[model samples]
Target chain A: MNHKNALTPWLFIGPAVLLLIMFSLLPILVSLLISFTDIDLIGLGNWDMIEFVAFENFIALFQDPLFHRSIFNTLVYVSIGVPLVIVCSLSVALMLNYMSNKLFSFFRVLFYVPSITNIVAIAVVWGFLYNMDVGLFNFILNSLGLQNVPWLEHPFMAKISLIILAVWKGIGINMLIYLAALQSIPRSFYEAADIDGANKLQKLRYITIPSLSYATFFVTVTTLIGWLQFFEEPFVMTGGGPLDGTMSMALFIYERGFQYNEFGYAAAASLILFIFIIVATLIQFTFNKSKEN
Target chain B: MKNRFEKLLITSALLIGGFIVSIPFIWMILSSFKSEREARTMPPTFWPQEFTFEHYINLFQNLNFGTYFTNTLIIVLFAMLGLLFNTMAGYGFAKFQFKGKEAVFIAVLATMMIPAQVSMIPVYLLLNQMGLTNTMSGIILPGLIAAFNIFLIRQFMTTIPNDLIESARIDGAKEFRIFFQIIIPLSKPVLAVQAILTFVGAWNSFLWPLIVANDQALYTLSVGLALLQGQHSSSFALQMAGATVMVIPVLILFIFVQRYIVEGFNTTGIK
Candidate 1:
């Protein structure tokens, strides 16, 4: 009876636990160990060919200009993209709060379409929009007698263009999150604010923003982590080009690992990317925790 | 008067936001109907002057979209089976109390924070070792049970009343029977939620599929669309048609299953 009791849970969870350990947990450990070694494609099967590099890969990455540039571009992406997405989504969510049920659901679905659509498809569509000559944006500029901007060709514009696409891709999910958060806030708080003669902006600043802090934290963390691992937009649309202008850390790691077959180097880069995610998330938690007190 | 004006302002803002959000999709669909010349013409055509199905024809006839769609179907099918396995594990966690249960659950939850990229290389190597590389199984294996999905199912299963299970056990019902007969039928909403999410995710997945299966025959719709874009880089209408084909199914699924999708995300996310 005791043995059966012990075995019952395992019977249910055994497959999932086995797979998770094999795939997720084991890979996590293997990757961490691999990050410490010098192992490439040829050394993949033959353990004898691998060497213990022990921080050499990390040191090398720190000195690599392209790696440095990738890190800088990722920071530029996160710092700008996270806040921009949050504000846009929040504003949309706030506006959405005013709509009737039928209208709100309609607009909600419209806003969410892009989030669910694959990023590659979105990139292709945006590529056409950002085309140098006959693109819609340039056509609009021409109509307004403004000079046609090289949206994806120029380095500065390319970064901005990539950020724009990221922001567009992200807004739908965050908007829905914020909208749900907003809907959960009790009406009594707003009633009290109104009775206290608080204006719209005052109510917003005090009640709405404070109510959204958790959602804001969630969004900021996710958006920051997402930007740190940014790959798809630049991969598809720009190919990390026209001058490595839109290259992100994720794309950089992918290029080194897959394209160059520098698996060891890519593993090291992936570890660094993991460290950035942890540090960023920890900072957000610390900030939120302190704010809570 | 103030209230009415406020309402008007809010409506206008939402309309503008909606318009901005829909423009690219609208343009993609519109351009799919335009001729190659019109699509690339100066001051690009917003509405195709004379609509045609040439691009759609080309997408099916030339691009082999049917194969890509079938590949995605196979991946999603296997992934759904994986979701069932996750639910069973979640049921175990939620109902059965064994040693180190809390510790085990937390460990699983913690895996959620470690991004998939961290594990990509080693997991790929593991797949290679299993001789699953370039097969749909390789693409499906690593994603069998994500921490988030396990957490989701666990959370849902915890709400199932204990007395029902106890009663079944008292009647000499085997644990598996109780799971398959009672718990699963009751957990329909969450199971449906997981199915929709898994379907959408597997359907949209690109990076893993791209890495695992390099063969043209095994390319999922997303990977296939990407490859199509590369080969027909200048064919705007053809690419748009491909995008339309890729997006339309998921969009249609969303329209029907959105309540489950929305509630699943909102509940899982906020909590």
Candidate 2:
């Protein structure tokens, strides 16, 4: 190894390392510290007025009904959204891999466009589509002689609308990941199966899915982490409306801190959510580890 | 006959899937040009019978959305500039020898798993203390140094050959100069990827901007577009026209950089 002077290395990384620490690392540590205090926007303006409150913020989070509802909403969403996005992506990937044509590859790129588009912007367009009197979805349903659905105004329907929107906006990227994985599988696997008189379904069962397990697990892990932190979509589209059925954990934390100016309580709630993601992620990883053996 | 039927099934399925995906965007564009009556009409018109530019005209004239648009562009450019600076740092971490570098790199990567929402309040406090709140800098400062970009760029730089660095070092080049001359020139792909991601994130950023940008003048296109949607009672169609205006930049951006953008998702997903 080329032994450069030690001081010189720090010189190269000094500015960037400093920026990351101040912006990312230090803020995270400070946030954890703030979770234990009773700080509000007033104290935010005057730092000395901030008072240490011990576990009161965490205790208060336990007492709040909205916190519980936020937890419940987050769970329901993660469970529903994670699996649906994975399955949709996997199915699309499978179809793309199975097809024999130039047009199939064309479809892949076209579908992936929305994956990169602004999630906030897409949520707005979809909010318009979910609009009761004027939305395209309700209009189409009404035109088909079906009962008009209150997509955003109703509670359960609002949550479902949020879920559907997430899956649609998110699936393209995950699909491409799986598509890359599926395409990399050797053709010999399928060819050998064909020689063994394996049908399409059997080949897929024995070879395709077995090979896709790694990609599936990776997609599931990241999707779970992302879904746990689901904020932008619900915030932009529904605003936790129609009896707060859709108030997510992240949104609650944001509203607690940003909107109502309850820094400690929001920070505590956020820490709790962060803990949940960590625990859930660990459980998923261990479960995946066992399945591998 | 049976094979033909199967082909028909697959064809129809693909068509339907593609149609569902494209329809929302197409509707957004169409509804923008429609009159309020046509927009809220009983069965919404699929195509505007009388296409009008009045809505587009209103978005520019009445709304003054150009300010938000320009604000987004400025913040986005600055964020991209920040991304370049961070990438150089990432390259240093990957290739350069520095005391505490490995520990520092791991520390930076570890922070990636920490949800950024938790830090929103503290960062707000930081900006408040610095007297930077409610400005574009409030939107841009915290965004400028991203852990994800650092991780991604370092991951890319680690793949570059060690000999290139050695050759440059033997030429008595300084670390920063070598990074700029050799590493960066060859790192165009990852840099392009970084540019697309940073630009998109900055352009579409809502939460941070929503919190920091307290004034109408400082609003990014995203927050402005949403607020505009909420403000207008006269014409929903006109509001859509405003959205079309907001989205046109991103769509045009994608049209040129489509491949890099796709490659971006793949790379980020890999991490």
Model 2 regions lying over 4 Å from their true place = A1-3, A100-102, B1-8, B263-271
lDDT of 2 by residue, A176-242 (tens): 7787678678899989998999987898899989888888888998899999988887787778877
TM-scores vs. true structure, each candidate: 0.96, 0.94
Give, for candidate 1 chain A, the lowest lDDT window spanning 10 residues.
Answer: A1-10
Q: Which candidate should be chosen as best, given DockQ against the real structure? A: 1
Going through the candidates in order, state the TM-score of chain A alone for each one.
0.95, 0.95
Provide the global lDDT of candidate 2 against the true structure: 0.81
Residue-level lDDT for B194 in candidate 1: 85
Where does model 1 exceed 4 Å of error?
A: A1-4, B265-271
- Highest lDDT against the true fold, candidate: 1
Each model's total of backbone clashes: 0, 0
